[model samples]
Target: MTEEKIEQGTCLRCGRVATLHRGLCIDCFRKSSEIFTIPDYIDLTVCRSCGAQLKGKHWEYGGELKDIIEDEIHSSLQELSGVEVSLEDIEMRRGGEGLYHVEVRAVALFPGGGVIPTRKALTVRVKSSLCPRCSRIHGSYYEAIIQVRGSGKDLLRQEEAVDRVLERVDQIARGDPMTFVTKLVKVRGGWDIYVGRNQSARRIAQEMHRLYGGDYKVSSKLVSRREGRELKRFTYLVRLPPWRRGDYLLKDGTPHRIEGFQGRRVKLKNIETRREESVEISSVETLAHYPSKEVEMEATVLYTSEREIVIMDPVSFAEVNIKKPPGWKRRESVKVVRVDGGIYLL
Candidate 1:
């Protein structure tokens, strides 16, 4: 029989004769060395009300609870250098209220090609606490107040302005949970909106000024001092213009109906000339504001001519002759607006 030859490899510890890796067998190195380390127990705090998780010093929102816990687990794990480690087959069981027992298999990929698997069991203690924002909100804390006041003569227009403020608040609150309305107080002349955050209140005021052809002013007052910092309460005053959309105004002795706003410009439709024009918002401020609920009337067309049309007033039931628009067509009914003492066809 031929003599069999035995392979010899130097293992740093056992002097084994087999495959050697870094002066040691792979199995012996794995058994003797530490692949990774993880804490035996981890603590995670959560907001009881908003379901927000506490990460470090801030509250994080908008994720599944299980995913947040997994992140916490990953954050607590420490891996060896040159070893790509990952967790697999993570199993979690609720031991009791605010307690979680977790079992996970960690796979460490060593440099140059070796895999070491380790299993660990850890306890996660879930602590429930009120986050900073939620705590302030529960205490009815407000940093700013938005005062929505309308200068228009119509109370309906003022109410509409208030409604716009409310809609804007709802939209802004969707992004930031801290941006909330603490209370809405209806006072004389307008509505007062108490906001939880000053930044959100300022944004709402600026948006109202941009869209509604109005102006806003901000003021602050020293409320108190805490933690060696001054706490100031802010107030945002949003004032709507005297004329709103669809109202009529007299520009340079001519009647013009307010159509709408376009980026700080006022769109107007001249009642007498039957012309549509856009002018600077500041220029409209010089015009005489005329707001009337009965400005628009549907009249029965009695006669039609090239430059004139006769119609029966819907309210007075009397024949009224008015200048027709350039492309005015003969129709049974015509839309007219009462300008000064004359009826004009639109």
Candidate 2:
């Protein structure tokens, strides 16, 4: 006897004996099933000061408003199981005050077999507010103070060194948005820079000490407390060396031009003997005296020889015999420096 087989392809909605998906025909399934759900509208928070967006609980410097809106929409959608949805295109138009109408064209793929083209529309409301960083910046908040001071006797020299450090601060801020200069206050001897981040201040101080020989000290003080965490403000005191490169240093009545620096020591070349010398940066301040009588001026060359050259003194216009510097040739005008009652060709 032939067994009567049970029929199993009836759609629950249309009662059609056909191929079924989840007990429903493809047409009925597509009509009744929603692959994903998106809200009718979404609210986005933006920083009015810097154009940053607030995602979840954090503030990010994302580019452009349209790109941010697309990201928000992706996070807002809820997809059902066995369905994968991808947005193919997005069209945005301004819809009256602070509202944007977003239209998304998407494709949904079912794991077993079907691909459905879909379209979604939603409204995006943009709300402007101040971000945390912008709030702190506007309020003049600072985490560190960099004090740039020089040990030189000349005020012009001190000012020049301090200006270099100030220029460096701008470079550091480019890579790190959180690091910024809040205020610059001119003090008696040098300038004080109030910085937004503590780590940035340390970088400035380290670079300063490395290029120009100097000493720096970092001190921290308890400033405040928030959320049961202690907040501390840091102070970096940077002192440049008394003598800079190219300055004349007097060692036991002998004049030496400060050539360069190597690690913790300074390199010097004797003006009279042409001998090279090295001295610790820490001890140079005491052992070498900054030639107060040092002055550089242009002189007229009267005669030239292998080891010696004659020049007309710039001040007195009288011929003066001086030792020619190494690799120096005959020139109409020569650079000469007066140090400790002696004239030497530079």
Candidate 3:
């Protein structure tokens, strides 16, 4: 008589051929029998069709599993912060037997505040499934958020902040169960400078430098100017050294009292009196020699028709206007001195 071979059956869960059991396979057995441990307050439900597991009481089929996972994450966030997360409307797709694809929307709330003034949103597409026996598995294809908070006053700032937050989220999600991850695909808007004046700018720059050291850049620029015909107004640019910190005060919502000067005027003082010299000088020839009561002054900066900057003293101002200095024509660099009210030769 010929020896008979045993027929093998396959597991419905993993599709691996069964070794010892019949009907339902061992892999399927473990998956079906395994219990999912959830937190005490987390609400969970089960699929009625094949006794498969489901989460939340409102579970429905045909919806993407990724959407379900995102809902779970949002629920967890709500539990942590005690705030409800609003989800934006989006389309979801499902693939394979247990796989799903979806775009999810959610906002993060700050402590003691109703959501942030700007709405922050995250979009995620993930693939996940639950076996007929209730085994759960998930994989993310792409995930990101479109907005995040920052200290800048423009769209780029918000985008940068969102990138930073999502990167941190990714790290947490990969390491801890309490954390979740998402990708940022869009940012809503930009940041506004909280401090607007020169003093405020200095303070802000100083503080940032003190905290972050040489790792950051803090500077300010003039956005607009209103000049009268008699008083020619010019915009000033102040650049703080890297790693300095100070506050920039605001005036009527605009930055003022900033360091540095603009235009062709020298700031002078009476050496003996230690007081500011008035701009109404009687005559140019009266300023012939360095007075014993000389007050230090910075060089006046003049702009050429071509917008080139030239630095000279009040005495040489007329000469420079009439005839450009021989060496000055070939000079392309500005010499900055370190003295108080110092000179800058351009």
Q: For residues 1-346, write the lDDT of model 3, one tens digit per residue.
A: 2322224666556777754132334445434532112122223343533233344333343444344554554554432222334555434454454433344444434222324212222333332434332221123211111222333333443444434444544444333322333222332232222211233233333443332222233333444455732322121122212111111112222211112112212234332223443231122113322211232334454554443455564534441322343344544333332122333232
Q: Root-mean-square deviation of each candidate, in angstroms?
A: 8.1, 8.3, 23.0
In the range 1-346, model 1's lDDT, one tens digit per residue, is 2332223477879877655544666688678776677888888898888778887777887676677777877887886666678887677899999998988788887665767788888888989999877888889999999998875355787788778878877788777778878888988778899988899889888888877876678899999999999999999987777777888887777778888876567889877776899987776687666665667778889887778788987777888877666676678997777766667666
Higher-scoring candidate on lDDT, 1 or 2: 2
Q: What is the lDDT of candidate 2?
A: 0.79
Model 1, residue pairs in steric clash: none
Query: What's the TM-score of each model vs. the native?
Result: 0.63, 0.64, 0.20
Ranking by lDDT: 2, 1, 3
Q: Please write out the lDDT profile of model 2 over residues 1-346, one tens digit for every residue.
A: 2332323588899999765656776578778987677889989999988888987897787468888888888988887665689988889999988799999888887654567888889999999899877887899999999888875366776677667767777677666767777888888767898989999888888777777766678899998899999999999887777777887877767778888876567898987788898988777677655543456778889888778888889887888998766677778988877766667776
| Candidate 2 backbone collisions, by pair | none
Flag regions of model 2 displaced more than 4 Å: 1-43, 56-58, 62-124, 151-168, 224-229, 261-265, 280-294, 305-307, 324-328
Tell me how many clashing residue pairs each candidate has. 0, 0, 35
lDDT of 1 at 139: 94
